[model samples]
Target: MPEREILALRQRNAELESRLAQRESDDNLYRFLFDTMDEGFCVIEFFDGPHGPLSDYVHLVANAAYARHAGIANVVGQKLREMVPDEADNWVARYGAVLRTGKPLQFEQELVATGRVLSVTTFRIEPAERRQVAVLFKDVTERRRAEDALQQLNDQLEQRVAEALAERGLFAELVENSVARVQVVDTELRLLAVNHRAVKDFEFLFGHRLKAGDSLPERLANFPAERARSEAMWRRALAGESYIETIEYGRGARLRHFELRFNPLRESSGRITGACLFIYDVTRQVDEQQRRLQAEEALRQAQKMEAVGQLTGGIAHDFNNLLGGMLGAQELLRQRLEQGRLAEIPALLDTAGHSARRAAALVHRLLAFSRRQTLLPQATAVGQLVKDMVVLIHRSVGPAISVQVQCDAQLWPSFIDPPQLESALLNLCINARDALPAGGMIDIKCDNRWLDDSTALALDLPCGPYLCLSVQDNGRGMTQEVQEKAIDPFFTTKPLGQGTGLGLSMAYGFVRQSGGQLQITSSPGAGTRVDLYLPRHGETPIARRPPSEAPAQVQRAAARILLVEDQAALRMVIGDVLEELGHSVERAEHGPAALELLESGYVPQLLISDIGLPAGLDGRQVAERCRARFADLPVLFITGYDQSAAQGDGRLPPRTQVLLKPFELPDLVDRVITLLG
Candidate 1:
């Protein structure tokens, strides 16, 4: 040992101590960092073969947190492939890159083995002692879920926005096409949008164009009160309030009712962005209310006319009864005088009798017009009916108007009252003659049709099959105003003395009562067409022949007669008349008395009974009783009431005769001889 060798050795030992201390300090710092880090830390070691190729990944170290997350114990020094087969190959490649390059790498990946999203950073550390890769991983599952939730919310928001926009577009289109006027404005009361109707109407109202950025139109100022109300509404709407109100806008000369609705449009931040104003014009509705009040007035007038008809019908019925007795007695008086030495007075009596017959015929016409006369409704060929009317019409009109028919042979049959229908045809032909003045053509056309529901509804009729009989005239046409009221009773356009106005009205009523409809169409310059729609009927009708014409005459008869009547005045007159006619007569007030007389063995050769009696036994019932007992009794039943009551349900006695009230004395006497003989 020399002195120089000792100093050199001592210097080397100091340097070596310093180097060892620095290495220990660096190791302590790395340990502290690994232990205190919040991030999970793990180290993976890659083994190399002699050929310098990587063999496999081995887990060399893992923090306590990393071990807990892996759900394993003592994972240190375990091969990664053996511990987690699913993540082993991927981690080996990633970690080997870091270890070989010594470059840091960071990426986000999902750990398949743990089903957790993670961000991992890997780097090589401490190459001098042991070669390994250190990886730091942070669980990112909650972050990923939050991002997914935000994305879903964004998608939903976009969908809602699209739906809202589509709804707005639909609303805009509806307002543009609506009869109502519509406008939109911002919170500042500046106009933003206006429907075409609103723009046109406003322009017409204000006499100006409405342009963008323009101030409120001058029309708004005309209605100061409405404008004030509108301003208040807009203020409320801007404050996020919704309201509905009816407003009147006018300039003293023009006025209209507008139903206004105000709504606020809000943004995502809950601030009012604009306002929507919807306006609906209710002028037509307002006008209709006024028309209803006027209609009420007209309805009252119509009711008054209906009351008059009821009263007239009742009076006429009673009058007919009295007339029948007078006519019957006069005929008997005339016949008796002719048989006596006072035959010269018979001519005067015959003249009086003839006047009575005329009055009776007039009563028949009254009953027919009122629709109270008995009708035997049957299916008659419309074309045939029209053709038959032609010859009669020519005579009735006296060659003034030519009667023509344009009917098809295939025209369907209709259910109608033949006699009354014939009378109606006569009345129409007479009217046509008067209208022509210089002669015109009258067309009677028949058609078969099936009216649909829409047409029937518009015509205010039943929806079904029908047969139409149309009467068209080339005479003077009526005005629209006249046609509207054509069916009103006694409302005639002719001169006051020229027409009664009931011809058309009676026809209308008759058609209506028969479950049918009538329509009249006329223009001022064009021809008039009167159409009758009758139900299609199937039952056959009895053939009708042309009417026979004859002068009024009374026939004489002789018999032993039983007369039954409830009215004392009528009973006296009838008994006197029968006695004057060379007949032995017995009188009874009711059916029971007549039956009592018959039961007592006072069998008369003839029975004459008034149909309506107060004893609850009518003339028909008496006839039924008498025929049942005698089986072949000659009976004649007379009535001022409905003839249908005697015929309904086959209630009339078989082989019995009937006389309608207000009959001529000749008709009654003739019926008696015919029945008895």
Candidate 2:
């Protein structure tokens, strides 16, 4: 071989060796990248077929991450439709796009099978050994969720800032226009600006109008202390602190409490520029506090008065019992004396009976004053009720007081105890008569008035329309102090023995128990006016019917009557009254005895039992037991109490009759006859 041929072959062999080494290095680098990449990678193969429908792309290969995300045990050489049939249509479209264009495409989508939101990148990679497209998918759910949450937070912050700005605008307007004193000042404690109230108050105190650049500490002595507190407050506020404080002002001239506020204003640079001061005159609030204290004191006094009233009521109750025994025995003795041969003693016995009757009246008045009297209220016409009391009032006032009534033709009827109203009217008439040295006209009027919301608020009472019954006297009126204490029990300016000082109190209580309000308005020289506001019931008012010329005849009944009373004197008196009415009467001293009497072959047709018995069984329980035995039996109960037990709790049978104690003998007889029939 020649030397030149050897050199050329050697060069060609060296070039071939270098090319082989470089190709091996490139292969190793590609393999490392394909195996170690974090993002999921895969190849999707497509085929063109006659069906014209695209066959689902086949998964030539898938990385471990993408395989696990799809919950696939093994994804190598699997068709996309078989691995994720639900997502096959989407994969086929992307695969076709990549294969047809032989270009890369990128989009974002959520893979439901993997429960992952992914950013996907697909590209056509014409493999040297095979034709296929590689796809890359990366989970981006966390990043997307964080971005959405950040957007929501920004939106909420903007909304809150807008609301705060709105509130600030309103507050600024309020501060500028408010009657309270408001001002803005610099750190040097010079007055920058002030509301009209500040100018007026400061001028009133110092006799000078405050202006900008005015030293506040010199004009107002309180400004020094206020400024000191303001400085400390602003310092803390600018240092990222929030503060709220209340301080007192104007101590020397007049003791007035003003609400003082110190707030800092800042610029965008977060530096404090000035401070705002808000001063509110709390005089009305102070006055309200004082009034509340006074009301509390008055409530305590009222509680004490109530305690005294209870004691007085107990005494009156005992007095009524004594009066009962006395009146019953005296009447019995007088009746016997009238019938007996001891006829000469008739006048003496009559005089004694009159005294006993007076004693009973006194006891009744006492009970009324103590508010212990049981009230029996009924539907009553105001016009007629007032008319019925005219005669008695005329006689009681000794004809000196002329009664004049101006009743509205459409006056609403009232539900009240008739006797109590009569007493109240009579008491007012007498008082009016006494006020006038000579005769005077007493105006008694009833009218319908609606108390709307404003009217009720002015009166400081509940809101509702009510019927008003008013009495006005053309006589000397009481002073303001007297008017204030007029409804207090036993409080009177009259001579001690001349009055018990309970007439108005009883009237007030009766109205209250009737669910009405009693109000009095008077002045020293103006005649007194008393108004009773009662809740109006929407029912037709019944007028008084003319009485029949002849009295109605009594209806007869064969019902036997049981008279159970512990007091012997009352028992005998009641027995006599019942017998005279042509009825068989069986008497028992107590409830147990009455039960025993009934058990011992006495089936009384009616049970009339006294409530207050010495034995254990009360009238209500006796009625209960009797009702249990004979469900349809009629029971007439008489009691000093209000008989609330019979009214409530369904203890008494339906249609049970109850009569208050100390009723007249005639009244009792009439009730018994009515109930029996």
Candidate 3:
């Protein structure tokens, strides 16, 4: 061999040796990678079966990890169906497709034989003709359980979120429809949210609609008078203060009241972010309270008036009796002087006369307070009476007060004592004039009123048609306290010496005695109104007798008279007066004594008896007993406190006359002669 040949041969051998060494190293690295992999790796070979092509696969090679995952050792060269008899056919189908199409696939499955969950990936090995597939898998049973638990938790969380959203919707609906005016405002005083009521109320006050983001100041700018207060309240609330207040808004009939609350809205960190306003209308409630207060005051006034009436009536009755005796004695003494029998004591007689006249005036006042004054009641047109008194009322009230008399065209006639009624009108006018020292208008109105049960009950009067006489004045009105006692005797609002304190009391007594009702309505700074309700006289007005007419003089007659008197002094004076008038008089101390005489057949032509006689049998009873025997007997009643004797619709015997106490001897003689004749 040549030297060249030798060298070439050596190089070829070295190259061969190098190539062999590299192949060995590559094989060792591949074995190490395959054995040390975390995933289980296996190679499968497909074979035809009776059911279909590629129906089964045999494990040709498997890593150590594959043995652990499959739970089978020495699994190489074993068919998958044999190792896992209950395995689903879908496993074979999925591997078969990877082999046939030479595509990679990944899936998760449970191994029944090992009771393990596995994530599997398969791919066909190169060489289209070879029916072989490589599979990589990982045991993932614990990981799958963790994933399932997480999914359940996510589903529960979604359900809770949906419920929370539903609850929020319901709360929003309630706020929107609430009757109370609700609003939310930001720190900048801009409206964030408002309920239906808030919107409506805002529009009613400002005549415009409100929306979110509108400035609160702008909303209240129309009411400049209230804007400052509203702004201050809002600012306080935003500063974390809460407050509630009642605000009066509007004026006159459109006036309204609202209770408003401001509450600070805060964040979780306790910092105030805004304020919430809640408003509620309280107009109706306030009005109702005021009306109830007025009703209570009116009831108190009525009770006071009733108490005064009772007290005065009792006092007047006792005083009348005393006056009767004193007047009677004086009249008897005066008769003696007139006959020229007491000429030597003429100065004493004159002194007695002056005292008697003064005593009569006091008696008149007592009767007026007691509502038992002798009254000559006649039906008179009220409109005409008011027309007649217009001039006098104006003169009494003074020129400062503008007095106006308004009479309805169809004014009803009233049954009242003309003189007493005139006095009451004059008193009312003077009081009204004093009230308006600075000058104002006064209205005197006369009209007809038909009171129903409810109105009558309110006024403490009987239900009927009445003549309503109202005197209204624009003046410094009375307070609630003064109005309550206005009708009580001796209750006066005037200063000392300015008023007698009996003006209203006398008016009240006179009206009550005439079967009428009296009401006074007044309020501070609102002037006063006095209403006089007189009973309607549904008959034609009686023609007034001319004042020039004198009493008819009767011829002296000797008549048998049964005189019943309770007081000894009064009885003696009356008996002497009857005897002086040329009448045969029989006297009794009381009704029983008088009855004894009448029952014993002591018949008298006339019976003059005191109605308030002592004992069980009164003057009326004695007269009744006398009349039983002498049916034609003429009775003349003498009384100081027995006003009932004067009442009745022609029920008494013919020639019956009631002579009030304190009568003159001439008057008594005239009555006796007229009845006897």
Q: Candidate 1 lDDT, tens digit per residue, 88-116?
A: 66776777777777777777777676777
Q: Counting only residues 3 or more apart in sequence or on different chains, how many pairs clash (N, Cα, C under 3 Å) in candidate 3? A: 0
Q: For residue 75, give model 1's deviation from the true position in Å.
A: 98
**Stretches of candidate 1 exceeding 4 Å from the true structure:** 1-384, 542-677
lDDT of 2 by residue, 482-538 (tens): 998998866778875466566678678878888788889888767888887777766
Q: Write the per-residue lDDT of candidate 3 for residues 1-677, one digit (tens) a residue.
A: 99999999999999999999876644543453355444577888888876577788898878898888867899899987777756738778798788877767767788776778887766676675778777777676765674474343221110001111223232343344333577778899998777667887788777878888999898788788778888898999899887888998778987889998778876546877677787877776577558655654454344334323433544355446546655665776777778777764555555555455444534443354235335578898878877866755655566678999889998778889875786677678878888898999999999889999999999889998999999999888998899888988657777764555667887899899999988999998899999999999888886644323433455565788888898999889888877766778899998888877867878788889888777887777777788888888899898775355644442555778887776656667667777877
In order, candidate lDDTs are 0.66, 0.64, 0.73
The C-alpha TM-scores of every prediction are 0.33, 0.36, 0.34
Whole-model alpha-carbon lDDT for candidate 1: 0.66
Which TM-score value belongs to model 3? Answer: 0.34
Each candidate: how many clashes? 0, 0, 0
Best by lDDT: 3
Ordered from best to worst TM-score, the candidate numbers read 2, 3, 1
Which clashing pairs does model 3 show? none
